[model samples]
Target: MSSTDIEPAESRRPARYHAKREAILAAAALAINEQSAKGLTLADVGRRVGLTTTSVTYYFKKKEDLAAACFSRTLDKLLEILDQALEEPTPQLRVRRYLSLHMARLARIQAGQEAPFAVLSDLRAMEDPLRGQLLAGWRTVFRRTRSLWGSPATRVHADLYGARAHLLLEKTFWLPVWLDRYDAHEFDRLEARMMQLLTHGVAAEGQSWAPELIPLVQIQDDETVNRDAFLRVATRLMNEVGYRGASVERISAELKVTKGSFYHHMDAKDDLITACYDRSFNIMTTAQRLSDTVAGNHWRRLSSVLASILNLQLANGEGLLRTTALTSVPAHEFALMLERSHRIAQSYAGMISDGVAEGSMRPVDPFIASQGLVALQNAAFDMRSWASTMPRERAVALYASSLAFGMFDDRVLEAL
Candidate 1:
């Protein structure tokens, strides 16, 4: 017999290997959902799959490889949503369909209809190789959505539109879990309000604000060239690793500088975190100014502002806000950040009020609606950081659509 000739048994090896790999990945996702990705191990996955560690290793050479496989599988589900959304008749309807399906899927996940997946929550923990793979997957999904719309303008709109979708899905599905509450009807209203806001401007009918009359301030720094590069690196490191876990030594090593040099820039880790909060505030304020200018109906303007806020959080680099939430920063500084966040909320509420007065919005409680909308968006951000499988565009689209439903007039929501 020729060496090139293979028996039927050998030919089936590849098929069997693929099935084994799928089982291992499914087991890993279960382990992660129950105990978090940090606690997942090869042995845990093997036991869950009723296999020996050695047999599991036959598919995934290492625990990291297994983790990557689990993460990819989760992303595959998200991509499936995008695929369904693209099949809709119009770009606008495509977006609506996408949001509806995403919400339903999220509900299923929350109801324990299926095993929990941790790709989103553990994305930051993934090694670079896995992170790259995830990003590539996201890009492919976006590209497909863009192609379906077939217009440059629609593609641009799709970016923000898609982001809103992802944000809403994550918020609706994950927030209730965090708060230990389940209100499907409440989520439905939230989704409707978000869509209304995205499609219409927040300013009510016959109401207009003097756009050019808004005041602008100028700031002058004497030390124009003096930048706190060390503090910047330190903050990012601390945010990524947590204050207790992040060492000055690691920061110094990352910067390729000496410990003495790091000490020259900051007194301690606490000081660095405080500085980061200050910097973040300034950046956030600037973003608020830009978002405030989005001109359209009351709903549209409000959606634009909300979209800007979500984008800012995502762009600030992962883990910064999470670190702020989980770490022990100074109480005074924490209070200050809270005040700043409150101010943003107040501004958003004012826009809603403006819309209500102008007849563009129906009679509704702007204060309660605004607070609820902001809460929904913030929850979505938290969930996105946690799930890490859904793309930022999809998250934002989902959130904006849901929030618009809660905030918009019933008539406007019905049109969307």
Candidate 2:
């Protein structure tokens, strides 16, 4: 009561201060999006808005403070998308539209042609206050989504469909920037196929059964039980700490097993890693099965399959591990893994080809389109590294929609 009374006597400066603070924040975001955040300066923002550095300083004490303000504004925009999507009539359609819109925004940003949207990857490295604000916005979005779709389903979708969408968009937008030769139309086609797979199941009617192919495993094990458990623990450790930094000792401790027990499970860490690779291959096979079982239109079936594949990865929380394997694994080992991953990509292409034949998808070069889609999704894994100051979920969604929509046909896209 006494504190409340004292506050009433204080000047209304806080309200006025916040209004000015928001303006400075908005200006900073604009500057960062126009140029690399790494080289951004408070002076740049002031100049853009025709203010002196001193005037900018009156609102933001430091460059970091201004950066924080920009981050907050970005988060607000992202949350708005989520809110609008959830408010749509059909939850599924809303989800799809949200993805499309989000991707379009990312494509625009990646072109360096527009202001960058807030990326979840970007927010990961922000200071606590900024991070908290971004997280709070995400929570509000999540709560609203939950009200539309039950929490369990929403959470599952967030991990599976949501994460898939995010990764897809991140890659499509960033790769062009990185390589400087990316085609936006090609990316659009790839996104369409991916979305089709996610919406439909993967198995084509009359598809023949083939023996489940087990990729070569370099790990030697005395017993399957020990091999399986050791691989699981090793995968977790490797994903968390990376291959070079991940130690056998830490994995053993987590398993509450002696070094001798760990050795009993595998010949060495390399062996365990190989086993983990084998497991990843096997998991993909299982996903193919689930995709085949779902009954729907070709696009619907493909979507189901895509969702399953993404769900498996999200369940593992091994996005970092996959990224590390691609970029940091020993060159020889990486080459082998890359080959296997390519095969999987080809299989995905085959599914799309089947869809076109079945009149579910528009005719296209499945192999080339699949490669682009794979590239986009793969690039998404690194989005966190680039956008370390933005909200993670928003970054993920933005990337996914971009990749998906970029692949859709002009006619289908117009309807969306």
The lDDT leader among the candidates is 1
Relative to the unseen true structure, what is the C-alpha lDDT of residue 333 in candidate 2, on a scale of 0 to 100?
76
Candidate models: Cα lDDT each: 0.55, 0.52
Instruction: Report how far residue 267 has shifted in candidate 2, in Å.
Output: 32
Model 2 agreement with the true structure over 1-416: per-residue lDDT tens digits: 01112234344558866656555665666555444343358788788777799988987788866666566665566556767777677645665666566666656756766665423333434456765765676556445544433233443343434334444334433332222234555557555654564343233333311212222223344434465666766665555444544568887787677888888877877776677777866666556556665676555555554444433333322431343333335558766876786787788788778877886655555764565556554444343443343344333333344334332211122221
Q: Which ten residues in a row have the lowest lDDT in candidate 2?
A: 407-416
Native-vs-model 2 lDDT? Answer: 0.52
> Using Cα atoms with residue i matched to residue i, what is each candidate's TM-score against the true structure?
0.56, 0.45
Best by the TM-score measure:
1
Q: Model 1 segments beyond 4 Å from truth?
A: 1-27, 30-40, 43-59, 121-129, 153-180, 185-187, 201-231, 234-250, 253-256, 260-416
Candidate 1 per-residue C-alpha lDDT over 1-416 given as tens digits, one digit per residue, 9 for 90 to 100: 11123468755687777667667777788776554555568998888878998988887788877766676666666667778887887766666666677667656766767655544555555567766776676556546654444444443344444444444444433433322344655657655654554344344444322222222222233423122555555555554534544577887776677788777777766676667666655554554566556566665666665665555444433212332332245557666666665676677677778767765665555644555555554544444452244565554544454355432222322222
RMSD, every candidate, angstroms:
9.4, 11.5
